[model samples]
Target chain A: MRLNLGLKTLSIFTALLLVAACETAPTETGDSSGGGATTQTSGSGSTTTVVTETKTTTVQPGSQEDLVLNVGDRVFFGFDKYDLSDEAQATLQRQAAWLKANPTVTLLIEGNCDERGTREYNLALGERRATAVKNYLVTLGVSADRLSTISYGKERPVALGHNEAAWAQNRRSVSVVN
Target chain B: MIGSVQKIRTLLAGLVLAIALASVARAELVIDITQGNIEPMPIAVTDFYADNEATAKIGKQMADVIRADLERSGLFVPIDPRAYLQQPKDLQVTPVFANWRKIAAQALSTGLVRALGDGQINVQFRLWDVFAEQYLTGIQFTTPPSNWRLTAHLIADAIYKRLTGEDGYFSTRVVYVSESGPADRRIKRLAIMDQDGENHQFLTSGNELVLTPRYSPTQQVLTYLSYFNNKPRVYLYNLDTGQQEILGEFPGMTFAPRFSPSGNQVVMSMAQDGNSEIYLMDLRTREMKRLTNHPGIDTAPSFSPDGTQITFESDRGGRQQIYIMDADGSNVRRISFGSGNYGTPVWSPRGDLIAFTKLTGGKFSIGVMRTDGSQERILTEGFHNEGPTWAPNGRVLMFFRQIPGKNDGRSDKVSLWSIDLTGYNEREVITPGDGSDPAWSPPYNLNR
Candidate 1:
């Protein structure tokens, strides 16, 4: 009887996952375009254009430098897995080159997880994910002293929806210049 | 033979008197509350009478706090004061039992407050078993008027103990992480409030992020994880002196901190080179002892009530599960084999069960099981619910629940909630803002 109940739950979960995948597939493209349009509008306006350009170039405190590096600052991971994928390794390679160019810059790596698991274990997993990225950057000739890692567990999420797309985006490690 | 017959007659008389006394005592309605319906007992709390005009206003306020405390517990249903057939004046004279019994009240409480000068007030209360037609218990307290709320809690505790045969957790406080702003750029700070969400105060400004504030067993000291100076380390904050200091200077990130039962040491998890392990630090000598030497993650260590054993979560068994070991980190044994992963195993103060957060089939739940992983029971299931903290009495649990965001992905709200041990009386504990990671303090006297 218990085995039958377990099988029933598994079928229902699979059905829900299929529906979520279909719904999120089209929205993923729309999100990137929407973000692009906003950035373009700010860049074209005469008054705001100067502010936006200086904000990215000045490297001020608390500023996000993802635009200047010409690469995404975050790399995604598979479910419950911390081993860096080929794509993650490529992103770290670019991040390593950028850090080498800006020798005075120090970066903090933040590891985060989705909202599907336990808090404390997710925290530990996040730490592993962040450290995995940091160790790769070291292999690429980035100074170990210039990198620090912290895990926010499932506390901080860039995507708040409860779907595969959101979860995929939430399970990531981001490098922030300090 | 004649002398033996006289002795037998005397012994029979003595036995008969003992039986009569026992029957009389049982007639006072020794309520069998070990098991019953989830329905709360109907109770009536009459307004306290004041001797002076100044104290008359405070008297009503005291009754309000007491009513709120009992109602929040979900064990006693305070009847509406408008349905009260009796007035405050009725407490001065013997309460007419017929008046209360007519309203279907199982129990009745009455009190008197008098100004003792020098900002001190004398409070006295009496609890009556209306059904049994007898007085249960009565006590008096003389304290400063500023402590009127505490004085009310004392009376409620006395009634709760006499009727339920269990200690009350009304006068306790909770330390938790207060969160605000958006999900991506959130601010969390350490905040403390009364168990009923009164007298809310922030211990840290929202300058840096903070998480998991746990009170020590000895004093008003708290151990929590903070991102101060860009280092995520465990720090201690003294509530009385308003001083803060880091517990140790480790080469890696330190998190998941908890105090030992004796409050003489701190046990936490530190991550280095992509692996996390549990470590213990003595507060007196500042000595550090590494507990678990595994490459897999081992965190969230909680000591048993007697401080002899430790319970924690580890992924060494190919998945996250609960484990137990001795205080010196020997004889490690796995205690959880449920379907999904288990984390954050907190041993009950009663030392019988361990509460944990379980994840299965895309849902998170709060559950409890015996120390040997038998008789597992999941209490609450939701889209997102974790972090179970036991009430001081071990009869209740408090945790946080998060609602999934809307289509725009911007409507997520987290709130603190509690439920009884029997899986009934689930209630939402209102807070000033989004809250998580609630830790209940030990009973007030236990701290001393």
Candidate 2:
């Protein structure tokens, strides 16, 4: 009877160890998820959360959803164009105001292109688009150091379709609160 | 011990006998296949004979792969096996050339597979000109059971080389981007496959975006662009070692990378502060040089076969066009004066012509022209077609074709397609998912 009780305790210990291992494995491999949140549950029915927050707390005033809700996160462009239209200019004005209101918020402006052009040319055009937005924001008094930019070219198309409508939507610049 | 010894002796005797029979087969007649008709050569591939049950399965599989490879090349038509008059065993002993000619088959291929214990297989095949009653070529390969498909490809290469008087591209592979998922969250991974779309494997996970994978000329190394850490940079990946490292930590984005002919340097475009220009980096000394100092975009550089000149696309002339320059980035001259914007210019391995993607009349097409931009011919046109890569022999070009999705815009498919150098025999290269940016490797034996 005593031996049976000891075996049961050892198996229970092993089960707890496995649970702990699974919980930790995702944190190491899930770097793209950004937040890298780790949840731990105690054996006594209590819960603990260990979140390894990196690069988001200082510059991001609130959650991403909150930023997208309060201010626009994207601006669209015309076909094969990096120059801003009237609509794009107005959107950038609003984005500039948002940046002014949130002083601590840093921005990452991602430039994207439609899938209709060459990959290398699209990258250059995307950079032009992002730079256009950044220049306009600078004129509105946002510090250039607080804003960084990257162009994804046609590699990251928001629209999967080959139609003009999808391509129109894919050519845009998005602002992400770091 | 005696039984094992006897088995070894029997195998040796069989090898010697096969060699003797092959020499006799060669003495029958000689057919010059150099001037065959423009139409595909009609061939019959018999099922390979097997020595055992396990080998029988592999033998049938290998023959199927070989037949598919030949047929997909658009140079040969594989006659249906059901129309074959004799069994595989009978053909292995001796192919009745008159029977194949009677069935309208100009070429006949027969083979045998033997199990050499310990999971080894011996594959022997012969290509015969049925009308001329001559053996074109015969080869034997021994490999592990798992590598039976490669053995079949090697046989197909032998047949192709013997018939065409050109190096066979069958033994090479293509590196491309496999795209999946919805448009907004599309996942692109680096993938490689045999030239015939066999032995497909993904080299990278979709967690990071990768593009434009180009194989090295002398090694199993690939140079490509990856958006890792949100920094778009050039990276080198070794196929044999499964190790990858960023080519350099440039202060800006680097894209459109291609390896030099010697695989000792990489040429790509680096964009910073709204300008993109061509740059070259020597892998050995980590030395970086600016190849082009244009304010406009200069990218998609390809080295000539001799590595003395580079052909690339640039918009410095107010519109996108093809340009050529010396290895040190001097004597820049425009090579494209067509009606459309030209980009993604790839110099053929033969170093005589350049393949490029043209955008005109609101459509995209793949075309080729002389290095001096003469005798321009558009190969294929569609809604979206780009990224033309050449086969190892420089006789064929492969690119991606993107078909429009439905009204909901959900099922868009991008597939790889190949075309002959003369702009004939266009065919789709099948892949498991959407593929783009295909770069063909040099022939497998070139480095050796």
Candidate 3:
């Protein structure tokens, strides 16, 4: 588990570099000064040169780290509500596309809830949340056979705070590649 | 594993003598506990008389245990021994009524412990009405010396039942979830202790998450939910043998399990895909019956004492509410029409009231209503309270209350508390650390 988190962090770093690469020139000069390269972006009749290290560590596609870093592995819900928001659906769309590309990878959708609800009711609510994600993915052409669900029901929490910020993070459904 | 003492062996020594003494009694003293508020009866307890030093020490400990038991019930206040005018040795014949009355004691309890030469001892106790100047009742227990604590509880139970006209809950055990660590990654283990929080033992290691443990009718078995090997499922445990097993074969998560009153069946919820439905499994035959076939979530099923009806919380009516149906999944009707969401509706053992947790206005309250869903009374309310379990007598309810965490929620704490059915005498049941989801066992059989 610790190793996975570290790798997730590393892939997130790699993703930031790719985003930076998009803002700069598409091509990098092979000549480097002190292990750095300069890229020029030309637009609006002006040219700007940006200096940075142009190095990237490629993460294996269709892997758990790839899902976390690129397509988003989880989506949040409102307090005591399981209906998917537009943002959650957008994330699920990317996840569905990713799953289509990696057909052999089975996904475990874990439904979770904030600690505000009772244990049993939250169990039901969490299941609904997970099912909402699964149903949406199915509409996006992901097979039902490749997707399974479980509700943590506030038992497993990602954020441990009493305020809304933590609760919003805790109430989510994460798609785990198994 | 400290509460491994052998079961008690009872020998009623003073039954004939106490009955003979009761024949000449007048103006019997009694406590009416059904009222909302009443003064606690003042009772005097003396150390049990013993000859040897070792036996005398046990006698004194027994006296202290009995006094604590009676005091915790909130029906009696055991007087200070320093104010007692009669010593242990002086109570061999009878308690001087004048000395006890001068101290304003309404009742007196005295006992004697004698070793019977085989690592066994005979503990005898008697309750006396001070103002009436008459003997009330007496009993004797023959058991190993290590069972002195149980002997004291038995004496307290006898005194309580004799005065209050209700069974005493002293000799019972409580199985609960002992929690520790932080809020996001809490460690919960199954733990059992005496009603007074003695003999604390953790039934399961905290390696996995466990919750909502319910005791069987036999008191030797429990059914709870566990996240074993990351497969959330219902599991059964045998107290005597320390054996655990999954309750059923399910493709998804199975939780909110409770044993039937007959101890031969279990009713629980199995969540597959996104729908949760209630089901009943016969323990003997392993036959599973689907009780509710709705798309809405239905869980937290508890059976009425008679086993003719089952009460559960469901969202079939658009939101979480308490509902009751026949034992065979017929005549389903919604019983809760309160202001907020209701869940965890536990049927009272007396078949009269149902206890539940209600969330209203962003707060949680423990309340009870009649079987017909009338006379709804909120016993206690706070920032967060859930899961109310009744004592066997149905006159008290124990629930867990969580103190909301400050800042990061790392300071979050949960503890077990009990309140009278009359909504009085709310006291915290002290545990080694934090506790939750307490289930009270039925009154133990002294002979067992």
Candidate 4:
């Protein structure tokens, strides 16, 4: 029974992740272009020259921007568990490929937790999550020297909901180019 | 206990108007605090007698502060002074027992403030049992004119100890993280204030994230986790000098710091390769010893009162549970067997119980249990409550409760709250902003 429930939750979580990624990707581009147009309109004669720099249009291969936009720089974890899920492993595999392409790029893996755990315990759990991602990248032939990790505990969350959906998003690890 | 005098700065004599032998028996008019529920004793706090207007204002202020201190303890209720038939002048000689009794006051507190030639103040106070019409306890304090608040706290402590037979926690301060901003980008600053939430001062500028500040035995130093320069490590903060330095260099992230009972050592967790283990560091020699070699997380270690045992939370048993080990990391034993996850186990100052945060069925609870994990009792439960810290007296526990915001959880309000050991008298300790991880300081013991 427990295994069935776990599988059901995982499926729902994967569906939610797809919806969230789709919703956020366009919003990010739209906000940047909207901000650019506002800034140009405030100037004397640059309103017509305002250009929307979309993520795909200005993508640089092997760059941090490209890693975030194309390869997916983040991997989510289950509550209180640092072991990577199947989907998380796939994301890390993509991230490892990107890092292997960008041989000169070093990364910082930031581990984060949901608000459900205690602060001190969450700090340790976050480190584990970050280490899990770093280990996967290392297994994929990434150099250990090129990776560093830190846990932000539950102090930072990307979602603002009190439900399971927000918590699933908050409990994640993000590989940032340093 | 009645004859005890706490003299500070100067040993000026504490005047005794009348030493009635029967007062000793009347002092037995005590409140049984071990029980969870009890009515607050009605006591009258009259303004202290002063000869001039300048001293009169200080006298009134001291009385007001004393009244607030006693009332906040949840043991006593300072009766309204307007119904007093006698003025401050009546306390100059003795409180007329008949007048105090008419207002239904079971106890009465009276005092006098005098300015000395050396620009200091001499404050003396007496607690009287109205039903017995006898003096219970009294003390005299000589301090600088600017320290009237501390003097008032001392007087309240004396009265509290006399009536309840337990050491008072009023003369202590609390160190906690003052939180503000939204959830994702919250800015937390190290803040300290009197136990009553007065005399608040922020120790950190909130530039770096700080958490879980624990006071040293001397109360002059603090060990906490800070993301200073973006490195999450344990750092030592000197309270007096406003100086901070990272603890000894470690291989990985060091966090969940707590000082030993003697304040000469610190126990914390250092994470390497994602595995955290408890380690002890001596301040004098900077020697480090790894205590736990578990692959699972073991952190938040707190010392037993005698420094002989350490209680912490670990997940080595496939889930988070409370565990106990000797001071030297020997004799490791798991104590908690309940179904829920247990974390942040803090030993009581009195050495009888360990307070912890328990999460079961998505509800968080602040609870306590015996050192052996027997007689588990939940004190308070809510949507999100964690990090239980004990008061200096061991009679109360302080922790933070996070409530969802009206619109969203991003703007949730996290506030510090305190509750007695009996699971009653839960009161919010109001701060200027959101507060968390409150650690109570040892009694100042100013006169010791």
Candidate 5:
């Protein structure tokens, strides 16, 4: 019965998650990758298929000392994909475990994107990405009420240079927690 | 032979080095035009060639109107047409680039007025990108001589869009609630005009009290509040169809009507006695959905681009601030938490920044903050500057400022103005008579 309840809840959450595009829904949000993704060239001119947009991140049981999470100070998605890479999940899992231990903690998840898309669209997408991470943590037993999301879109940029490095850094969601 | 062979090798290396340096320059020239010199583009507006007396009268009036429209942009510095190099009539052929460049003009406007045989006038205008040495656009419109002002406005819009790569607000119109006289004898009217400050038409004629006049998302339809027969009601006006319809006849007062981004629904604030909240009504079905139920003043709601979420100004946090709620009015979160009080949160057409009115230090200023409460930057500051509407490109903000207690308190000129996001380009928008509370419309889709 417990297992059935867990599966039922998971499926319910899965449906709600896609509809809300987060662990929770904030009002009308559209996740356009600003524009579509830039086809990444892998040396021989062929393209890589989109295997996973967002990786299912699981918080490993640990203390802060056990997880010196890179949390990527930055993560780059293709155009507008808010999905996590294998590396991104590893970083998120560590951060998730930290939040699991720190129950009294509250966080501000800031959604951000590159300068490639329209401002409003990028902002909504950013919010959606952060909400995705927040929802993943909620499913991992972290309290959903503690996580709040806001989209910076292309406004508050970390790097001002209009280059690949700058765009890579800017197209990321930083987990700002208090 | 040895020396010649060595020279060829050296030349090849030098050529390769040059190409590398050129490519690096292309990458390094990152002019972060986050802000531009908001100084108005210097322009010359000569009298368009007119035919009849009415056309001649309109030609001069429209030239003045275009000048005012561009000057208010704070982006263009209007040059005195008296100092023009060539008459607008001569501009039909070509212009001497050297002379224009000599006058230090980066952009110029040339137009001609023609008398259509059907007792109407046709005006043609073009904006020249002097630096690019090309015409941004050449537009011709035929209207009755009385619409000379609109024709001038159309010319200004064409010039504006061509140069800025955005739709011009000049040919557009502003529907605002005009207030006059003292608080006891205050008269309110739904006033309309060409974006260039001509053709002042009063829809309500100051006989009835109107609160807000918001433009429809797709058409010339205007949705606003009217206190007709002492009952505050939401009303809609189809400018072309000459049709006026009531949105919903709720028992309470309804105000602050704004069309959704798709133009299918109208979101507004309704008050039942002392209780106020936000609601959305489908124009087709007349079905109303209450989005906010807080006893606090939850008003001034604007939808996100996709219409799934909304941003509004509320006093829920014990003070007037900005909040974001879901489309169903769930998961309400506060988006503004800076020191100042914020209201009239307008979502950008591009859906990024929210233009708002901020009252800090007892002064009203127009500003924009990110969707979250961080990085709140004030764009324009004044004693009484409020109500910011974003240009279609999300580059400029239009608002109004009044010189309080100036000219012995008799000359209370609350006029429309615009400024770039960078706070540099500040210009007084041209409007017929004194204007206030300007709202920019989206690009004309089916509305025109």
Candidate 6:
């Protein structure tokens, strides 16, 4: 349908502009250990491990390598809950490690929801979710000095189909590394 | 025979005329009140039954807060206290239905209190349907005198939910950072309170600067941004067990974070070495996925109801605008194209529309539009309005507005407010202290 095509074209045009703008913003983000836990200071050890040395570990900043993140990095929440799970903690730890070395970095935590309730409630719900992550990192020995959190309340999304997989993806806390 | 035919013809003409009149009556202008004030279910709140000691001590401050809460819902109107006839207690035996009906009140509410055998005060109240001439709802709640305000708000929420099929947001809680002093020397701490602006409590002292605080979808966990060591990161607090933890240890800055629709994952924005993108982390497995890979500054990503798509803000189009993409970052697109730069696009749970902030011609407004970027309409306009959150019904949005009183800082006053999509009812949603960045919670359907 023309509507679908138009949507695609509009997004591509906007995405191109965003990518170009970000390219000049400066790549100063600390290397992420992974998802949930993003502490640059290891919970167990203080020795810093260079994430870039493992070429296979993280996507090189501005490199030609594919940046499409696999499912291995996304953190999920329980129903109506925003606490970071052990798995979530691990992911954030990885992200934290990456952030420590990259001092000029900033990020936006987007709270999202699956399609089941009202929009306003979801927005508030989304906000609570993003705040949970920001708070968790602040306690993990990461500086509250560098973080900002915002909620989309289920307005923006990444998947299109209407199914369980889509819903699973919809119920997430996304990290936008600047 | 000639006479008989003439008479029959006359009768037929009369019948035709009658039919014409009936149709005309049916076509007459008929307005539908079915759309009744979806704003907070307006109810008249007289003073709550309080100890003569309490009422005399605080004046009517408690009653004022209740009235404010019901009104702030954009749903209820606490009838002017001057309208009280028999008082909130006179309704126990029989509320003068005629008195409330005369005020055009669809529902009536009243409250009172007495010491319970358990030492805690037992507050009692009733909600009446003036039209139906019956008590719609009434109950007794036992709480410490300190919690009387919270109980009063719960009463308002009950009446609101009974009249409207939607859940009430009054009883829920909000946690946010309170900032004061100079920008760099700002003193910040975490504060929590009922969505109605009562029972405000500080979670942490404002010695260090706190940025943002968030709530857990399923539990009492609250996460937030703090600057204890001059570095910004996320921290969590448990309401029930009083436990605390840190989310992650990222290198540069890990700012924004949110729980997935199921409340199982955290989707947040991270900026490393200047590259901004959206990523997701599984709470159970700690797995990670990059949702956006544009060279543009992609931040503020929100999920669609189904989670397969996300909407976010980006500078890819020369200015900040809203965009959506596949969950896996396969198909990316832009959603805002109005005269202003758009930021903070949130999907409705109903999957029909998205709400956003429009910065146009130097003025800021909150508006909504279809997912495909058509049929956009601005709901509220002012000197500045940003950080819009929704009511459970999507019929209303809550945002903060700031207006400086004078050139001096004394004029810089910020207030929380709610407005309907039709733009008919615009009022302030009350918050303790100067309020900003209000996030509405899901209808609190949980049992007491």
Query: Who wins the DockQ comparison?
Result: 4
TM-score of every model versus the real structure: 0.85, 0.82, 0.90, 0.91, 0.60, 0.59
lDDT of 1 by residue, A4-91 (tens): 3244233222222222233224354233212322223222233244434644665443224432325446788888889899988987
- Candidate 6 per-residue lDDT, tens place, B34-134, comes to 26354444467666655666642322555676677667655566778786666654544557878877777767666666665665665666666666665
lDDT of each: 0.77, 0.77, 0.82, 0.83, 0.62, 0.57
| Candidate 3's TM-score | 0.90
lDDT of 2 by residue, B99-149 (tens): 898789888888888988766777778777787676666777666677777
Tally clashes: model 6: 180
Give one digit per residue, the lDDT tens place, for model 5 in A30-118: 11111112112111112211111222243232321123222322334555567776766665676777776766667656567865443
Tell me the spans in candidate 6 whose CA falls farther than 4 Å from its real position: A1-178, B1-43, B46-65, B87-90, B102-104, B110-114, B120-124, B140-146, B207-209, B239-244, B305-308, B326-330, B349-351, B402-415, B428-435
Kindly list the per-residue Cα lDDT of model 1 for residues B359-445, writing each as its tens digit: 898888999999999999898998888899988888888999988656233467888999887677789988999999999988766
Assess candidate 6 and give its lDDT.
Answer: 0.57
lDDT of 3 at B206: 89
Using TM-score as the measure, which candidate wins?
4
Chain A only, candidate 4, TM-score: 0.72
Candidate 2: give the clashing pairs: none
Kindly indicate the candidate among 2 and 4 with the higher DockQ.
Answer: 4
Tens digit of per-residue lDDT, candidate 5, span B1-448: 0001001123122433344345432222112325567334566666776666766677778788888777776556778776777766566655665667767777767666777678756676655556555544465665566666656665676667655666666655566656565321346577776554455677776655565577877867888766565445789987776677888777655766788988999998765533458899988899999998775667788888778889988776866789999988999999888886778888887777888888777677888877776678888887678777776667778887776442222344667887878877677866655566577766544123
The lowest-lDDT stretch of 10 consecutive residues in candidate 5 chain B is B1-10
Candidate topping lDDT? 4
Model 3 residue pairs with clashes:
none
At residue B366, candidate 1 shows an lDDT of 91
Q: Show where candidate 4 strays beyond 4 Å.
A: A1-19, A22-53, B1-18, B21-26, B406-410
Q: How well is candidate 5 docked (DockQ)?
A: 0.01
Clashes of each: 0, 0, 0, 0, 25, 180
| Candidate 3 DockQ vs. native | 0.30
Please tell me what DockQ candidate 4 reaches.
0.35
Query: Model 2, residue B105: what's the lDDT?
Result: 89
Chain A TM-scores, per candidate, are 0.68, 0.64, 0.70, 0.72, 0.58, 0.59
Ranking by lDDT: 4, 3, 1, 2, 5, 6
